[model samples]
Every structure is written in structure tokens, then in C-alpha cells.
Target: LGYANKTQLESLVRYDLSPVLTNPGLIPLLEKEAAKQKKRVKITLKCETGTHRQGLLLEEIPEYTTLLKKTSFLTLEGLSTHFANIEDTSDHSYARKQITLFKEFLHRFEKAGLPPQRNHIACSAATILFPDTHYQMVRTGISSYGYWSSKETYLSFRAHTSKELNLEPVLTWKTRIGQIKDVGPDAYIGYGCTYRTNQPTRLAILPVGYYDGFDRKLSNSGHVLIHGKRAPVRGRVCMNMIIVDITHIPGCRLNDEVILLGRSGDERLTADDMASLAGTINYEVLSRINPLIPRRIVP
Candidate 1:
């Protein structure tokens, strides 16, 4: 369930019992020991639901539901499923079908006379879109991280609710300028020399580049903030650096803080802006950040 695996759950259950079992054949040994002691062992199963990324198929779900019914486990605490797409309002037919199927399975479960204590089917998007689907608890992801599934959903929720929730962004980025140089009119900049100086230009080079998850496709199209003002990215974003025209901003220097993705003073470079330049989404922009870079959390 909810992106969990057998190995992980098994570890949690086996931790206490693992050490005391003398026989290497532990399952039999533990059962025999339990029989001697007149105690029983409990087992839990995690079933998959129909999620976009990972889950059982809708067609295959009934079989899983049937399996759950037949199995006589010591503890059967819950049944669950996930919605495929909750952000898309233009078409919710898929999500609606999934919800319907889950409801059908729950009805079957009840007919089997083995209703569970928990029956949940609502993630961040579904929870917002269909609160009635929340039988017990909602499993959230992106929304917990201060972003809605999409702009349409967020706007709709805000319009109806008439109140803003206190959600803060949890990530920031900054890098030092790698180098700085000046070029006269007609001078070419970067690979393919795609950009020629319209006028004499002073440029600052930043060490962050495509390899570091800055999109190479951005090229001359992206924007960066320098000296508290916006500067156009020049030429191609190289393997480990990008050049920006800083002639307009006075007092540009080496080792000045280069904000690849974050705010500086009143200027801000959002993940959405990065996505726009890269022809991607905000999720991709933030997740692509290389793990090798140090991350520090500030209150």
C-alpha cells in the first residue's frame, strides 16, 4: 500500500522475533515455539490500488478484492485504492471510474461479512476534489509540500473556501559566480556563437549548468537575477556554467551569490519559471536538483 514494499514491512515485524529464534528455519521454528507457548502470530498484507504511477490495474482489482475476501489473516485492518488523475477537470472519467470500482469492491467486502476498520481512497488531489471518498484517512504527497495538483484545482478550492492556508515552500538554491568577462560589440558568446553582442557587454559566468540539473534547452532563453535586477541568459548553457549579460547591472563581481532557483532580495526565480524555460513542469524542475549538492534546512 502507499508505495510500501514487503521487505520494509517484514523488517518491522521481524525485528523483535528475529534474534530469539534458535533455528535458522525461523518460520517453522517460530510457529512451533508459538504452538508450545499457545500464542499466535499475526500477518499483514499490503495490496495495490489503481494509481497513475504504481498500482494494480482496474480490471485486475476485483481479483485482488476476491483474494482479500478468501484469505483468513489474523488481522485484516483495511482495504484501499488510489485515484489515477485528480488534477484534470477537463476529463475526470478515469478517476471517477476508479472510484466507482473501489466502491464496488468495498460493497463486496461488506457482503463477505468482513468489513475492515479502515477503508481509505483519497490522496492530496482526491482529498481536495472528493472529501466524501475519505472513509478514514487520506494519504497525501505533493500538496503536503505546499503545491496543489494543478493551478485549476488550487484556484477552484480558493474560490469556494475564501481563505488562504499557510503553506511554505521547503527548498532553496544558491551558487557563486564562476567568472566574469567583458566583450565588445559583434563578439560572439558561448557554443555555436548563437548570440552576438548588440552592444559592449559585461557578463557573469555561473557554475551551475545542465549537468547540475539546469536545463540545457534553456540556452539564450532563460533569465537570471544579478545585482537585484533581471539579466538575459546569453548563448548556450554550457556543461557546468551559464553566461548572463550583466552590463546593465553595475558592481557585478566574482563569487557574488548566483540564484539558480530561489529568491534574492525582492527578485525571485520560481520553479514554475524554470519549468517554463525548460519546457517542463515545476515538479521536474525541483526534483532534478542533483543530490550531491548540499541541502540545509532553515526554520
Candidate 2:
């Protein structure tokens, strides 16, 4: 629901897919597409309540609504906005303020007799933590995949709410050990010799690496689940390979299932765990997974 220019609008029109118009500049292009289709193209208008990134400003909403009325092809369907600081901090005051600003704009539009049929502002965090922000629909993103928007959101929800929110993780990243070897004391591993073995160490080479969305920053810091135990990463993570110390894992072998981000026995290496080690967010960890990787559903 993010159409910005004429080309995107044309494609959306050709496919008969409604998109959220983020800027007033696209209005003319939408009109042109509608004229060609000989029918009104239903579209939602995105208002910049506070984010100030995209969407019409408060003063521009009236003019945008007027433009919508002039064109026979443009039908106002919904109003939407985004939260800029909802998932970062423990305090949700800024997010609440955004909601307030959005509500004021919604009222202003209604007062102008151009009230949108559907109004949505809540993203994943708001949808789970603040139900009051749910107007007509909520845009559930990371949380839909069983990851919390942030640890703050989880804590805040638990502090205030009585309802239990059980989110089951949907994605599990798995790879197989390609090689197993033993390195003598003082042996360096991987490129640049970032890690040196202090003692005799058994290392398991995993096929998946930074190219497969494993963060390079996790080199020598991240842990993977091997035989229900934590196997520490060693040296630098290469484009297509990473070596982990598995000396403590009994009977480790080639082609053994490796848990990169999932449960193995009673141990789990979650997206959150990777995010913490990589100094990033869980969204990045999940979104950066290579699309070429096959996905299968399990019961």
C-alpha cells in the first residue's frame, strides 16, 4: 500500500490493486491512470500525523480531499499514518501522542464531510500493546511472525495487561554442518585470523553465513544450538561459511542439523538472540534471511 510515482500507479491500475497514496504529487498520475481505465480507482490517502516522512501534512489534507473529489477516477477509501518511535523505547508517550494527532486529523476530515471509510494507524506494536490505537485495521508485521516489536513493548504489555499474549514463532532457520575439524593450540581460524585457538578445539563449519543473512558482526560473538548446547562462533563469518567451536558437543558429525535461529532439543537460538549479538533489531534478522532459502511448514 505504498505507491509513490506514476509508474507504480500505472502498474497498480493495470493490476486493479488499490494502493495507499503517500504524497499529493502522485494525485495527478493517479488521475491519468483512472482516465485510461475509464473507471474510478479506489485509493487510500496516507496522512503525515507526526512521522513527517511521507503522506500529506495536516494543512494539505483538505486540498488533497478536494483533488480527490474533482477526479471521477479517484475514490477516497481510507486514511492511514505511521508511527516513528513506537518500537524503540520503553516509554510509549511519543507513540500515544502520534495516535492523538492522528485522531485529531481523522476528526478534522470527518468534520469536513470527507471522512474516510477505513482508518488505520496501528502497526505491530500498537496492535499488540495498545488496542486503543486500532481504528479500523491494524498493520501487523514482525509480531505476526511471533517476534515482539521490542523488549520494552513486551515488558510494558506485561506490566499493564492481564490478558496472556502467546505468540508462536513461525520461522526457523536451519543449516547443516559441512565439515568438522580439529585445530591445534594457537591456530588461527577464518580470514584475517580474527580468532586464535587457546587450546585444541573442534570446529564445525556451517554452510550458512553472512551471505545467508547471518550478520558478520556475530563473528566470535554469536552462538548456535548444537546437540542442545551453545556452540560459540569462532573467527570471522565469511560470505558463505562460518566456523563454530563444537569441541564440547559429543559425537558431532558432518551433515548434523544446525540450529541457527530455532529450537534444538531444549536450547534455542532465537532471532532476538541474534539481534542482540549483532547489535541490531529482530526485524533485520528476520527480513535479511535470503529469499532463495526454501521454507516449509511444520506442525
Candidate 3:
């Protein structure tokens, strides 16, 4: 459920909260805390199945098991691992290999008389792509918010199954036009003169930029939805502002609502769209949005 060190483990034990022990080094610290508290502190052991980022390696599980047996107040509650390549591509072979290794370790723990009560290895992508990997519980993240893990994930699902995956976007980034300006032909817009108008242009200034997680790479590349039409971004994206060429949309006024990543009439710009323009993934696009911004539910 969570990873903890010596200090964090002490707090978790005091609160009687079980967490995932990713390192074997923490075993002694956990034993000390459990003994001090005079209560068994249950924990899930996270084995590094393949993702070399964290967790104890498969070769170290037996050593960890031996350490667990030496403690009277430390109980092994579950086993878990994470897949590193499950979301990057359409190929599932690496993920399947991770699942196989996870299962082998789970069986090994059972043979050692440390049969974990729960075994989980699937994250959001694996949960959708490989049902067999869902041993006990699956961690649903971006997909829970109605966004596909990646384009490859969507394609893989459609190619393998006939079931409909209806996901509605839950987040809509809305901002109003801060200012409107009319420029004559040959006028260069924004910093560094990155965008120069050949024809007279009507520019709508949006009060959102890199500071709000609207990536700077979107300069002169991204588009915003306004009046049900695509308005091209002009010049460099400033720290707190961006200009869009809305010359085609007539009758535009200051304070008009702009759709940064959402639906506007018949047009829509999704996190995927912004990610593509920014040279990143949808996860970064959505997660990087400033948390200080207010959120409200809408019908």
C-alpha cells in the first residue's frame, strides 16, 4: 500500500498501519519498532519483479523471509511488484514476463510458509490489458479519470477485445480570454518574434501558460478550441500567458471562455492532444496541472 523507511515505519507501526516494505534493510528497523510497540506490524513485501526502480530483488526474497521469521512482531501480509514497460508500447511480452516472475515468487513465498494473504502486480495498464495479472487488487490511476494510458493501450484493447470501453473525460481546463488585439500584416507576435503574421490577425490572449502546466513547447504548435473552431497558438508561450490566432472567429470579445483541454461546442481538445504538441504523455499533461487551481463539478 505504501513504502516506508525507519522513521516512516515507526509512525506506521504507531498508527497500526501496514505498508509495503520495498527494501530488506528496513526489516530490522521494523522489528525494532514492532518490539517497542509490543504489537505485530503487518507489512506487504514488494519484490522487484523487473522494474529496477525499487523493491527487493527476487534473489533477495529468501533472505528477507529468513529475516521475517527471526522477528516476533513482524508479519508478512502480502506480496507486490510493479511493471515498468506495461504502458510504453503495444507489446505485452515484457509485462507477461513480469507477471510470470511475480507468480513464481508468490509460489516460492507460499512454499516457505510465508504465504502472503494478498498478491497484487497489476497497475492501470496491466489491469486493462491482462486480466490474469490481477491477482488480488489492481491500482487504477489515469484510466480511472477516463483517459487511456496511451494510444498504444487503446489500440491494443481494441485489437484484442470486442467490448466497448466508454471513458468520459473528467477534467476540463477552462479559462477566459484576458485581452484581444488586432495586428496589421507583417506584425510579429510574442517573444522572439516566433510567429509573424502575413495577413492581418486577431489575437486572443489566454491567461494560462507554462506556469499553469500549459507546456512551453506548445508555442506556435498547439491549438485551442474557441467558437467551435481551432485557433492556432502564436509565438512563444509566456510564463503566464499565451496568444492564439482567432482571426476566423468573428464577434469575439474579452472574457470569452476558452477551452484549453476540453470540449467547446462540437470541437474538443484532449490531454492527449496537448501531450502530442508538448512532446510528452497524457499523464504528465494531466498531473502537472497546478493543484492550487480550484475544481468544481459540472453537469
1-299: candidate 3 lDDT, tens digit per residue = 56576778768888999889877788888899889989888888888778887787767878998999998998888988889888888888888888888888888989999998877887778889899988778888898888989878888999999999987788889898999999999999999998899998999999999999889999999999888888999999999999999999998899998988889889999999989878899999999998877889887
Score every model by TM-score: 0.74, 0.94, 0.90
* C-alpha lDDT score of every prediction, in listed order: 0.67, 0.86, 0.88
lDDT of 2 by residue, 1-299 (tens): 56457767767887877788876777887898879977678888888877877777788777887777778787777889999988777788888888888888888888877778888898888898788988888899988899889888888888888989987778888998999999899999999999999999999999988999999999999998888899999999999999999999999998999889888889877889889888999999999999998999888
Query: Of models 1 and 2, which has the larger TM-score?
Result: 2
> What order do you get sorting by TM-score, best first?
2, 3, 1
Off by over 4 Å in 2: none
Model 3 lDDT-worst window of ten? 1-10
Error of 1 at 174 (Å): 1.2
Please report, as a residue range, the 10-residue window in candidate 2 with the lowest summed lDDT.
Answer: 1-10
Angstrom error at residue 286, model 1 = 1.3
Q: Pick by lDDT: which candidate is best? A: 3
